[model samples]
Target: MSTTTSNHIGRKISRIRELRGMKQETLAEAMGISQQSISQIEQSETVEDEKLEKVAEALGVTKEGIKNFSEEAVFNIIGNTVTNNDNAAFFNNYPTFNPLEKLMEAVEENKKLYERLLKAEQEKNTYLEKLLSK
Candidate 1:
């Protein structure tokens, strides 16, 4: 079992399962494995080749498709083209962003701004109506 892309593979599996709208229980049953096993596999730090093949079959995808499946692969593939210093610059420019935190903040800010704008629009409309009536 190689640990190189265990997390990556697990994420890919989860994404594929979600895309197919298949529950973890369903996938576990189809693969003849326990639900816990499926969960562990999806969260595993390293996965066996046989297990990978089984997962690919169950997902109706190729092993390479699962193994090579990620935007991170783009970084990994371009690794040789970057030096230590160059890579440091890249990471500095685009530090890893947490999805949940960033999204939550954006949503809250958008809600506040949207409410403010709507209120202002309502006030403007009321003032315009009064002026036009007069």
Candidate 2:
């Protein structure tokens, strides 16, 4: 039996981040760091545990997930899911949602929520001002 080697943690993080449709800039913003720092972190072979945890949070994955990620394995799973009719019932029930698309949808929903909150706050302040004027 052949043993499989794990990819470098940094490389795995980078690949997962990309697959999740997250830009380095967005990750940096979430982590309170610069985009350049994100780039440097991705190039490093290893990252400190604390920083890795923060990166995992920003990328919406567990640290363990990033550590164990395998691009080839993921693609192989996707390929099999697409080609196998045996699993059609499951796929039909679940609809084979793409992770990247889900991430994008989540981000959009967050933006809308933020905008609505801002608008509500503004309206509340305006009402308060009118009450104060009387």
Task: Specify the highest-TM-score model's number.
Answer: 2
Give TM-scores for every candidate, taking all chains together and pairing residue i with residue i. Answer: 0.47, 0.57
Residue pairs in candidate 2 whose N, alpha carbon or C atoms collide under 3 angstroms: none
Report the error of model 2 at residue 110, Å. Answer: 36
Question: For model 1, how many clashes?
Answer: 0
Please, what are the lDDT tens digits per residue for candidate 1 over residues 30-93? 9999999989988875578999999999989898887777645645667866778556755656
Q: Locate the minimum summed-lDDT window of 10 residues in model 1.
A: 1-10
lDDT of 2 by residue, 1-134 (tens): 21124557777877888888999999899999999999999988889999999999999889888887877788788877676557575546644789899999999999999999999999999999999999
Clashes of each: 0, 0
lDDT of 1 at 37: 91
Stretches of candidate 1 exceeding 4 Å from the true structure: 1-7, 71-134
